[model samples]
Target: MTDYDIIIVGAGPAGLCAAIETGKEAKVLVLDRKQEIGCPKRCAEGLSLRWFKKMNLKPKKEWAVQEIKGAELYTPNGKSIKMKAKKAEGYVLERKIFEKELAIEAVKKGAKILMKNQVIGAEKKDNEIELIVEENKEKKKITCKIVIACDGVDSLTAKMLGLNTKLDLKETDSGYQYEMTGITGYDENLLHLFFGTDIAPRGYIWIFPKRKGTANVGIGIGAYEKETAKYYLDKWIKTQDGLKNGSIIEVNAGVIPVGGFLEKMQADNLLVAGDAGHMVDPIHGGGIGIAMEGGRLAGKHAIKAIKENKFSEKDLSEYTKEWYKLSGNDLKRRLKGRHLLEKLTNDDFNYLVDSINVEEALRIGNGTLTKKDKTILFTKKLITRPKLLKLMIEYARD
Candidate 1:
């Protein structure tokens, strides 16, 4: 019984960013099932300085709780490589506040946000899409010229609109985390990453400090693993003398789509972004920045569609093409690198860590590293180790 120029599902970073971009030029309404903007966050809340500059975000002391100076990577044998640099610096945020800030920007741009309103059903015609929203105890249908789906991993809006966003088990990773206070025995300034098949399988364990005594301790592992992510996390925490006594204030678990980037993100009057589109970093599984970027692009294109009065799939597909050129290709390359990393044995991990010097590690942490034809060639170590080099070459086959 209502109408809008654009309707956005979910009020996460992606949806809010989309609203910010489209609200200025069109009548945009955003709906979320939550009572508040950000509550019970599902992420580790770490963001790099590069992203802050890229998104033109000013870090507020209220939400940017802790600044990370660098990272310390650990191998299976316990060998550690510390990477520190200006570009490697970032922050661990109070995500609940950060997301709320994004929402404020969206509202300031003239977007109307309806919290606790869930999109229960959707229907699309040749031009406009109608959404059935459930608020309180009543259902109301709202029609819009376009619908942007930013609902997380279990998104139903896109599927209802006929966009398949299902992810295979191999493409997804199981993440489990605990926000612990009274944590100690680690640098509050550097991110800690532990990697090993026995430790986390194809993923890694992270400790991102939010304060001097509090941190988000988490792990990501193969979704198909017989042992759950919590099992590994709990097992590892018990071994950590300092973390063993920390009090957990919150527990978060979810499925992260690390691969399987969708080539098509749009239908006639529908576009998908964020985790719903599998737009996550394959290696690190970070999605907040990427999701916001994707959302911004979606909003930008939605403006074009509304201005030109064109809503066809082809017309809206400029977003998809632009996304690929902007980030898709780089993410694809990282995915390949992730696949190669997954094949490395624990010994290979130890050897690689041993081979990497502090400077080389810093380059990687600062985002100054990429592979040429020798994808696994980080140090000149691969050239000296024929067996490892051959294994990498064999797996590098696309």
Candidate 2:
């Protein structure tokens, strides 16, 4: 048997971030099921640069494939609105390279990583947690003072800990993406989003440009939809001039839990971060940034608990408290906005686009509307459709 101060499952952004932080002051081990770190990419790979700055990390050119200056939103009727940021541009990354770099950074900070290893079971005994793992075709047990579950959406670690990891069909989104090259007639510096029932059902379609001639084209639909994501994606692609002749270089599919963060993320001697904890943004489906933030905060609090020699749920409550302080309210409001948007029809989307400019539309779509912005939008909606005032009031309360 081997032992370590901390053991993290998954080698994605969140797990590696936790390992890097915890390894600075304690023995840390990270386990991933993949033979190589960051294998089988499953993300759109679009992230804002602000997250990098927030973590005090620099964006490396090696993994950053393209810089995005702005985004365009398209309604079902083909009406379009464009929003451009003056600064803090987003980037399309090679996720495989980015995740590997994170793992490499964690390893450089004295963390040990076991690739091709998976945790099959976890149990709490005495003051430590024991993990049963299958490594290199051998079953082994390892003990650790604390365990951080950063596994993906279908997290066995969270389930083993007896946490409520259940996700309703409505709360999850089925997503599929294709990396296509030999594309033309696309603004390489702009990301595009198409919204409508026909385009993506209750969800949306996104085109995130990678290199000059390549882009990640994907569709995410609410799990209640009967059709598969690939079906909608293929149908939408046939109508796009740029992607009609594009050759698919890669295909990836995954699920995203858009239900906001879990109510509780910590139990006795254990903490859950990343998608496993449902840290995804319910409105935008952006989770990479939130995952890293959750991991860093969890790792920091874990170190504090280690120093105090206290691992009870009460002692670890600080992680949940601090994490909510960081993003709790924002996520709640976003979830409310998402629910409200789902009630809108294609005509409603078209009306919204025709009524507002790019900046105002973006503010509404991104759920960053100020109180004054809300009041104005509400007044306009009330004037146009009196029945919607009740729903607007409900959304405002959220």
The candidate that achieves the highest lDDT relative to the unseen native structure? 1
Q: Candidate 2, overall lDDT?
A: 0.85
For model 1, how many clashes? 0
Per residue, candidate 1 scores C-alpha lDDT tens digits across 1-398 of 23899999989989999999888899999999989876777789999887898789988899999999998888899878777766537899998999989999999999999999999999986578999999988999899999999998989999999888898789899999999999888888889999999989999999999989899999999988889999999999999898999999999998899988997999888899999988898889999899999999999999998889898888989989999898888888778777877888999878867776665443443334546524546245688877778766665444
What candidate 1 gets wrong by more than 4 Å, as runs, is 86-88, 358-380, 383-387, 394-398
Model 2 TM-score, all chains together: 0.96
For candidate 2, the clash count comes to: 0
* Per-candidate local distance difference test: 0.87, 0.85
How does residue 186 of candidate 2 score in lDDT? 74
